[model samples]
Target: MASPQQYLNNPNVRKLLDVIASAEGVRHGYNTIFGNERFSNLSAHPNVRKSFRQTDGKTNFTTAAGRYQFLKGTWDGLSRQYNLKDFSPQSQDIGAIGLIMQKGALGDVLKGNYQAAIQKLGGTWASLPSSPYAQPKRSQAEINKLLGGSAQQGGYQPQYLSAKDEVRLFGKSQPQTIRQKYLSAEDEAKLFPQQQPPATRYLSAEDEVRLFQQSNQNTQQSSYLTPEQEAKLFPGG
Candidate 1:
């Protein structure tokens, strides 16, 4: 049977985790809480929920912590799946790998297929350059630089690359047209009407009473005892 620490044992996974921690902004501080605070718990996930102001002055609430900044609910499910014992460094790596495997990006990640891996994980962690979120992001070139690529190839900025530039950097691609994406809720509802459960049937008060009486009479009729049985039960009754 595979142990819970399987991902932590693999050298490739260890290296990948190091890179990912840097991307998530927790390389030096594993217990780095959301909004740049520090946590001191390792026994379990530090599910300290908080609302902090963003650079834009908007408030954002989070329970995100540790290297990958796992949300409480997200960690709960991943921990169960990966059998993570605690929020230790090893456990975090294993749990992070479990998430990568869940997204079908583990194979790509191990193969050093950066673009493919980042694309797969875009919607998951909002830190990657491929992510569509409006958060602070590490550019494609910047992350590649972490992977030991030249500064000329991987730019210095912490921003995304243009489509043309990305094509120039990484050869092949699969661009998603607007039509290929899923429809919005209202449009989807128009196309496929919401399915409702069948209505429940209920008997009237009069019908319920009649059914109870009929059932009681049937029970009595079915419970008929022989003369010998009646004599044994009630001698003179």
Candidate 2:
């Protein structure tokens, strides 16, 4: 008979274990981060359930068992939300590993093993667990094929944007622009009705120069204007 550790080493079992662990970790993390005054305030509110439903599509779970169920449900929901399929088992496993890693790292950090925690929870942390599902190689073509070719036809090219790229895009793209890009025409029309267009106030070259001068004067008068704001007022041509 295999030892407990040996049993954990089994690919399939490990995957399942990891998924559970990760789900638990996420719950713990959320509770920890938002558990105190904020959570209490929200929980005590009469409209808390409705608010939670709006944000998470479900109210906060009351009991421990209910919370556990909610966590599992959330994991599944996220998978669907991201259109992350075919690797359900793997995704679950990774999530579990992440939780375990997070817990271990936290414990280590609390114990002042900051470096160790950082090392273990670093960028390659997900690959640390010995599971067959860890880091499953996927190709865009394969994903497109899996998505029934509609993904390709719809210009849904899958590219892993980095955190910085995501931030940059978020800063650059307005809500309207993003919605227009991602939402179907029918959906957009339903969600956003064409209101009377905002009155267009065209600025001539003189108006632009006058506005710049006023902005510059304001910046010079007020010490509150940041360097970036000043730079924006007089941008490089």
Candidate 3:
């Protein structure tokens, strides 16, 4: 694994990972990029810096704090190996870089292999919603824009069950029952303030995708919210 200094030595890799971090929602000092305010509000405080052992013989703590959303599980394996301190923003940033380096995406990232880098990093970042890995993938265009690079065309395969595949499986792609879906609590709170946000918890991309598939039969279905709904949800820009 590359040392934090070595990782830092390559500014482009750092920048790319920073873009991923931003995509992962690490915009604040004490919260994930999403609005998870109040660090001390959980069994394991969201802003917890040190790793702690829970009563169930498992460790519980904020591994996802800092600017990079470093999970405690990942940090547990990496902390001593890298001589990391606590879960400060700097520590989180370094840990994120370390994760990318460990995933073997560092070199590809430095070489401007956006899609390759995204593919490599996808193992760790679930937010890359469009990855073939079936995890939640963010927009490649948006990620590329953040990296100051042009979008890498193709190579991404959506993991959801497509309409054709659904038809093959169920004879008819559409589910017999289509219920009206409300905005996800996480999304509703962030996009629409009228509704109260639920307690914050880490929802993996797989969980999100599975829920998405359960909701709509069309694997390639578009936005959950229509333009009118979106306009109401996000009145501003």
Candidate 4:
């Protein structure tokens, strides 16, 4: 079945995540907090409240932490919605995928439609192209490079699910009861969060289309809160 962690194994998805990390300046530090705020726990969201100056030249108190630079409100909403268990690297990746799904970018992302995906995602990540925030953001060319480049031969390949996998997920005959689209703690546990996940072969675009349709049928469409909403919810976020 199409699960959160499965998306992380996708070449395009992984590259997109790398783009986010690079843009957020967390390429080497998934544990790093926003604006040099400090923390130690991986068991849960490190709700580290501190004021930090952004490039905008004004200090905003924030809980923006981890590889994706999630603010507390954003993280909370994602965690609860996706059943993300902690602030661990695995959980963070899953949470990021959750954000992608939330922003309606997963279909475009699966198809390596970078511009469209980035457009949908920009609001949630200010450092991405098309962001509403006035912060410094990456150019399309820069994002292309991070995604292994569009013209680079044999650099990245699209992922597709096998026929058997497709049948199991969508059913061969009568439609099986639609299952939960998000992962459970038990499901997440099967992933072995401590270890680096193996390279993932992914679902076909057709399968992805169906999976996306199935997911929309099952999950609530909760948009990421706006910058103003975040600031109000988290005070300095």
Which candidate comes out best when scored by TM-score? Answer: 4
Candidate RMSDs in Å, in order, are 23.6, 24.8, 25.9, 29.0
Looking at model 3, residue 111 earns an lDDT score of 77
Q: Per-residue lDDT for 1-237 in model 1, tens only?
A: 444355566666666666677888873467788877887788899899988665467878879899888889999998888777799977777778777787888777667665677688877787788888656788887788776662132346444445654444444565554223334555444444545333323444554564455564444332344565456444754
Q: Using lDDT as the measure, what is the rank order of every candidate, best first?
A: 4, 1, 3, 2
List lDDT for all candidates, in order.
Answer: 0.69, 0.36, 0.60, 0.73
Candidate 2 per-residue C-alpha lDDT over 68-174 given as tens digits, one digit per residue, 9 for 90 to 100: 11233444544454343533333434343444343454344334333344345433322223223223223435333433343213346644445454454446554
What is the Cα-based lDDT of residue 34 in candidate 2? 19
TM-score each candidate: 0.57, 0.17, 0.49, 0.58
The local lDDT score (0 to 100) that residue 108 gets in candidate 1 is: 74
Stretches of model 2 off by over 4 angstroms after superposition? 1-83, 105-237
Greater lDDT among 2 and 4 belongs to: 4
Is 1 or 3 the stronger prediction by lDDT?
1
Ranking by TM-score: 4, 1, 3, 2
Backbone clash count for every predicted candidate, in the order shown: 0, 4, 10, 5
**Location of the lowest summed lDDT over 10 successive residues in candidate 4:** 198-207
lDDT of 2 at 129: 30
